[model samples]
Target: MITVPDESGIVPFLRAGPPPDRTRHEGWKRWQDQRDKFIPAPRLSLEEYAALSPRRRALHDLHRTATHVNLGLLETPMSAKVTKLMRGRLRNNALNFEPGTRDGLMVSGGGYLGKTETACDAAATFEALWRDLHRQLLPGPIPGTRDLFVPVAYCRTPVRATPKGLCAAILDFYAAPHPKTLHGMVRQVADSIRVHHTTALLLDDVTRLRLHREDDQDTLDLIRELMDLNVTLVLIGVDIPNSGLLRGGRPDPRTGQWILPPVKPGQTFNPGAATQTERRFDLVDLDPFDYDSPKGIKAWLDHLAGIEDRLRLLQARPGMLTEGAMPEYLFRRTGGIVGLLRRLIEDGCTEAIDSQAEELTVDLLAGIPIRLGNLADRDPTAGEIPEIPEDIAVPAPAPRPRRKGRNTVFDDRGERPAADA
Candidate 1:
């Protein structure tokens, strides 16, 4: 057993180098640009991208981080259907609950949705779980797990997307400061974390791998390798159509298009209660916050206000030249898609500061009239648009079909209906 001392001088076995370098924004940018080609056109710029709060910024950074694995991902809803599926999987009897191979969870959503934040939070939660489990196994308490939530957005090490590269990346993850390459060191760290039952791995922006049509094998190999280490991997990314991340193939008569394998027990969809592999890693579908929903809107506003407050505090203090309010306004506009919101806000804020505004406000926000502005244009223009009232119930407009040509209903033959006198 390697004798490794943690920050608090508690030496048992595991030695982790300084958490991944948090100074690598350029690496992230390159990943983002590479990913943008495979996915739909992104709506956020790099400057707008930078203006997010550290938490929100990290979420967007994941796309850049995972550019090699799961690209061309789409946004799907975390509907009742998904939750029901999750509950079913969790309650299955055949689940092994083994230390090494329980079903893990994946956190995914729209490009701008908060997948990174969720992943980071899950990492923190898993570390806490590891500590709690360790306490059960050992007589004493474990330090360092108390604050497992390390912000990795600025980590400079270029993330490796290929199978071999990923292995190297994992090695680099622990090797920056030591004499041996990081991979050799990571095995020791992995052994330590594994022995302590702290092997859950959180990977954000996994969609980056979609660029390579053949790279899905790399992903599978990596996942299988982690599973061997008793590591529960949580991958975050934009949602794809089916449970499987990679799409495209021959059609299955049942679903028309070739149905990708569902995220089943041990990779089997809908594990039977008696099935032995039931308790493997799980797949979760995270939906975009229903920005139009009352609760969602409120949460978004609060996010905006909080960011604004952060910027205001920063500007008030020394050592902070430019306060950031772009993210706050982004919540106001994009409805709280942490990534896009940050992008819009950052761009707008920079423009505002460039023009020399003492403070940030709605006027400064106008600069980033992104797609949200287009959506807002469709909002009912009936009443004086007051601050969206709390607990207010705005009746949804009755559905109406758009008329062709003459600006009215169409005829039975698919032609525009003639106007009445």
Candidate 2:
């Protein structure tokens, strides 16, 4: 007969941990929980880990399951620069106390380039600072209002989002009840946004809204109106510029940046609002690491070094990923897409542990295919090394150009440079 594990026991092995609720990730409770509770597993030297008893090692390995290979969020050149731009906009709008309507931010990029995470990181940082400044209390608290002091709100656009559905997503972020009607939900959302002191509202996957659809137009209109609720909108999407989000929009003559027109006069419901003409917004791009440039290659190698340092593998050594052909091999394997790289690395680490190799090698990681990211838009590399060293060295200018020349690499005998047979 099989013995059942104890449901209630003082021993840790006999107890249980609740399964993570991934569905609620867009909500505040889940976001805060993940943000506050995600602790990377401690790294132990191979010797120290090997000396541990089997039980202890098993427990430690279990702990590692959560974050052993996790590099968390990384700061690339593109992301670092773009994040500064977005955060500055968020700050400018958030600090304006006498604001009629604050300028918003739009971050667009290909899928899995950490666009949403970068925006969310900035927003979270802003919220943390804002709350600390307000002594963690409601900012300018209104009497008889019991809404939570939500400094930042985050949600995703529904695949078939209408104005009502969009409003519902916003309301759902706060777990606030709402009526079934579009107008009611919008009113509740506007009121809740102001009462709860939400300074930044992040709507990710905004490109999901089809501009051709009549409902999406209404939804976009509602988005502009929400800006009037004393909040800065943080819009994130995949390729927003190409998504026709800027319908009838034109690039600035001097700046050459797409200037999205403000809410149409017919779309306005509240005529008492300020002379709403230009809804100030800026669009930033987050692209994958480019391996063709020296700066990009340096950044990519540094990124690898960072990941190497964070790894908890027993046999991992310095320059394991950054030295020799490993850097270029990895770049080719994952095509320099951070998300795909992350998946390949994490999966490779898991395989290493299971296989008792305890180290990531090109041969080991090569077979683990890069199966992440949205295939509809981005094509991830299949984790194959076509050439170990694919000309990563920067070619210096020759002292003199030659009409015909051939590289003379040494033969297997370790002799001088040789010509063809």
Candidate 3:
């Protein structure tokens, strides 16, 4: 007979350690390096700007508008729904613990729909809010704690979603060791969550959990247990055949009882009745950006202009424009997906710079490979051109006059002085 480890071993694993302070951690540096390419809008005073070198100042003006575009997702209807569900969870969980509450948010979308990014952004916002609240309530650092409190925890679902694997993922997030058995792992995870005061958990790529039908109930049960502990779970993944949580369980005709697919004898399954976990989630679908609508085109152009505005503030040049038919062409090519649009713009810009072109042209964008969706045969101009928004429309720049002589000098103030003729 196999002897289980005593509860003491499990108890030690559950003891809450200090929350992670990412700012001082090595991972913080990795994050900074990854995002270093995108220049954020500077909040420094004029005096601070005056102190930087020309190169540094130039770099400061070079903004990655893609981030701004990503941020714009918050304005979408899907995001509003997600926000409402999350707020409800926070409010309800704070007042009283509701077991198996309808607190989970399911974000489903196609590839390149920015589902993962949106979920991550939402998680970050929640975590920041939690940190601020913690600081306000407990100004003094807790002795022996790395962080005051962790309001949110974000992790990707494991490739093989076993009960032990899921528990190990949570443990790894908190830098804790896990016991070999599923029962011990669950206890440790639940305890760690309580000790850290984690109110919300975001799991990306949840589709990975459905690989094995036998483990489906185990995964769902784990989620239910987390919910019972008052942890609001946000599940993000690409579109799946059925609801990510409630797939594969069917009703038995003879017994009139719901039965999940058979699992190995020792494997864990949901002890509760079937269809119980289905009610715990609020599903939110993220559709691709609508490039055909006036509002959609306006949003796309405004995102680019927002980045240009930052550069203009620092006397730097603009990149993309809104004044011509180029917007319509871009909309048709990218089919309104944010990821494709970003890639198209970035590749076009690189090509233009390499070819010494001052502005992005239709010819430049046409050269980039279309690897995303099947748009090879689709004509960008086949559909009706979306009417440009009145406020967003600007008259195209007047063509520069040709110089009469080779030696004529074009002044900084736009005056073209004649040569010594």
lDDT of 3 by residue, 1-421 (tens): 1111132323211214543333222342233234323333444445665676765444433332222332233345555565665666554665565455435667776656677666655566555666666788878577886763556666766655777777776777777778877777787877787887878777666666554476755775666556555677777776643544545555446643333333333443333322244334556777655766778667777755553453223223454555556666666676666566666665655455345463466666666764444544222321112222222233354588897776536545654567733
Better candidate by TM-score, 1 or 3: 3
1-421 per-residue lDDT for model 1 (tens digits):
2211123433322223532231232333233334334331133444654566665444333332222122232223333334444333323311345543445555555654555544443333333444555568656645754322221221111233554455445434433233254345445434533443434455554555543445545454344445444445555555633434544323445533222233334542112223322223445556544566677655555555444433321122322222244333344455445445555545554554445452444555564454333334211221111122123222343477777667445446565557732
Instruction: Pick out the ten consecutive residues of candidate 1 with the lowest summed lDDT.
Output: 377-386
Candidate 2's residue-wise lDDT over 106-184, tens digit each? 8888766788778877777777677778875535557896446777888878777788888887887777888877667
The clash count of every prediction, one per candidate, is 29, 0, 1
User: Model 3: how far is 347 from its true place, Å?
Assistant: 2.6
Q: What is candidate 2's local distance difference test score?
A: 0.72
Off by over 4 Å in 1: 1-100, 125-160, 176-197, 240-243, 246-279, 313-335, 346-356, 368-421
TM-score of every prediction relative to native? 0.45, 0.79, 0.63
For all candidates in order, the CA lDDT equals: 0.41, 0.72, 0.55
Candidate topping lDDT: 2
Q: Which ten residues in a row have the lowest lDDT in candidate 3?
A: 382-391
